[model samples]
Target: MNAFSLRRVGLALLAPAIAVVVSVIVTTIVIAAVGSSPGDFWSAMFSNPLPRIRVNVVNQTAMIYTSAVAAAIGFRMGLFNIGLEGQYLMASFAAASFAGAAYVGGFLNVGLSLLIAIAVGAAWAGIAGILRTTRGVSEVISTIMLNAIALTLVGYLVDRYGVHEGNTVRTTKIAAGDMVKGFTPYQARDGQVWALAIIAVLVGVGFWVLLNKTRFGFDLRASGQSESAALASGVNPKRMILVSMMLSGGVAGLIWMPALFGSAGSYGTSFQFGLGFLGIAVALLGRNSPIGMLFGAVLFAYLSAQSNTLTFSTDISPSIVQITQGVAVLAVVISYEVVRRWRARLEQRVVSRELAGAMGATA
Candidate 1:
């Protein structure tokens, strides 16, 4: 790799490390300030029930990593896909709806249905991309609005077609035969290894390749770095924008698959939309690098799971998890700025030395 590429990788790795260290220090201070014993809190966070804790960790890790990858894809293309929540919700509903439809059948049939669900999600996101490219609408605004619309639409669908055979606002349980197989071990119980984790890792690797090794990836990065320059270089900014949004939505759809096809079983009005928002934080913490995003997702998941265990074992409130996430994001953002400035200085010094050496040789 070139020096620039190596430097970028080094800086990407550094951001998360600095962020984690700062978050830990800040969290400890917050714990003491809140009149909690830091030692006790730390212990509770670390030591917990073996089996249940493992399950929690695995579930949280899977969920966060899925969501983080969704957001990271958009971040790489210079699009902030804040509508991941909406896309995820829509995909989940689509998956559940297809599974419940009597016309749907065999295992291969079920796989095709999931592809349809992912396509639906991509189409929904593509709408925002269209607006942004064609009408000059800001993706941030359009996506946020789309999220509200998606929630309401899904809510209505649940009310109209829910399987409860009553007034409840939730979908019917997906047919067992149609569900994605081997994604979660929780099917038979609360905790076990399933194919979902492996799938998630593979997806992450796939994205890493797409972002780092492909021509499309290069165009996307160019568009992100400078629209004018990308346009000058023969990259179609509008097409890149639209494709990025669609890919991002597809990733979000994958996140929904685990919950809908996995043991979670059904969609409900109680289903929340924070995963998309959390994904933005994850992208920021990861500095939008695929590898960094994976690590960031794991750390965020670990803290979330730790919070659940801490809630039952100690007096600490679960709200601390949110605080920790916020702190981590803040630290990473600041660290990125710091690292950027340092890199600039280093580059300037190198240039100056090269110039000086040239002058000496000429003299």
Candidate 2:
């Protein structure tokens, strides 16, 4: 790339880099204040951030990325999508229930389950969208209520109709034909790498393409940036709201696949939750870019994975990770906005200078 392009890329990276540095410094200070050596904390924190040192880093990172992308979708449309927690949970239950009821083996099973999940998520989010567009309800309030409703609904379904194999309260295990194929990342270890990681990568790619390469993306972004401008430009604001929410919800549905198809092979009372709220934080850290989200998700995942090891290795509270994350998100938000303003000023200066030089030449 040319110098201008390189400079722009550097400018884009500056905020995230600063956020990471600040978070590390803050975390180290917190650890030291708690009577631990910063050196020891760093050593332990970095000791196993990778797959060789740890087994599920990549898989978990992918799941975080999926969640981030889900939130990012609504973010790009200027929507908070706070109900993603509900959307994913409800979708997971629906997918699992349907998958259990259907005996179709192989790719079809996985496909159908995923399809059901996507549909349920979209439909759930659509409720908020419809309310927002038609009745002028604030999405924040509606989604929060929807989340409560979703949890209550899922709890009821699991209690009343969940499959019980002996004592476990889980949906029937998806047949091998329906389950994602697992592979060992390292030859020596027996742990199976989550096959859903592939799907996560695809989700990121698709998100990028949808937002950056399509006309619909333009309209979506325009609406996010200024709904009035988009409406003036022949974009239907109401339709965009509905479509974007559904799209966001559809992607949110995939947040549990890593655990479902790869780890659990069934939905249960014990399945993972809360990824939707985590996704909001991840999206903020990433600034809603696919590439940024990948890095942000991995970093967050590394911290999350470290929480377990940190507990065993030191006297430090594992909640330190949460503090670090909150600090990082706050730093990124504040620093990035400042950087963006600075960059905008710099670009304006360059444009004015070029125009002045042209006028001088003409004179």
Candidate 1 runs further than 4 Å off: 1-14, 165-168, 181-190, 269-272, 354-363
Q: What clash pairs does model 2 have?
A: 106-177
TM-scores of the candidates in the order shown: 0.88, 0.91
Model-by-model lDDT, in order?
0.78, 0.85
lDDT of 2 by residue, 244-318 (tens): 999889989988887788868778865788788888999999889898888888888888887777777877777
Q: Which candidate leads in lDDT? A: 2
Q: What are the per-residue Cα lDDT tens digits for candidate 1 across 1-363?
A: 288668878976786689878988988899889988777777877775466556766766676777888888788778889999899889878876777673657676557656876787898899999999999999999999999999899888787778664556577676776665453434445555444556478778888898788999899888999999999999999999999999889878767566556566677754546877877888788777776777778777777777876766788787877888999999989998998898888788878988999999999
Worst 10 residues of 2 by lDDT: 48-57
RMSD of 2: 2.5
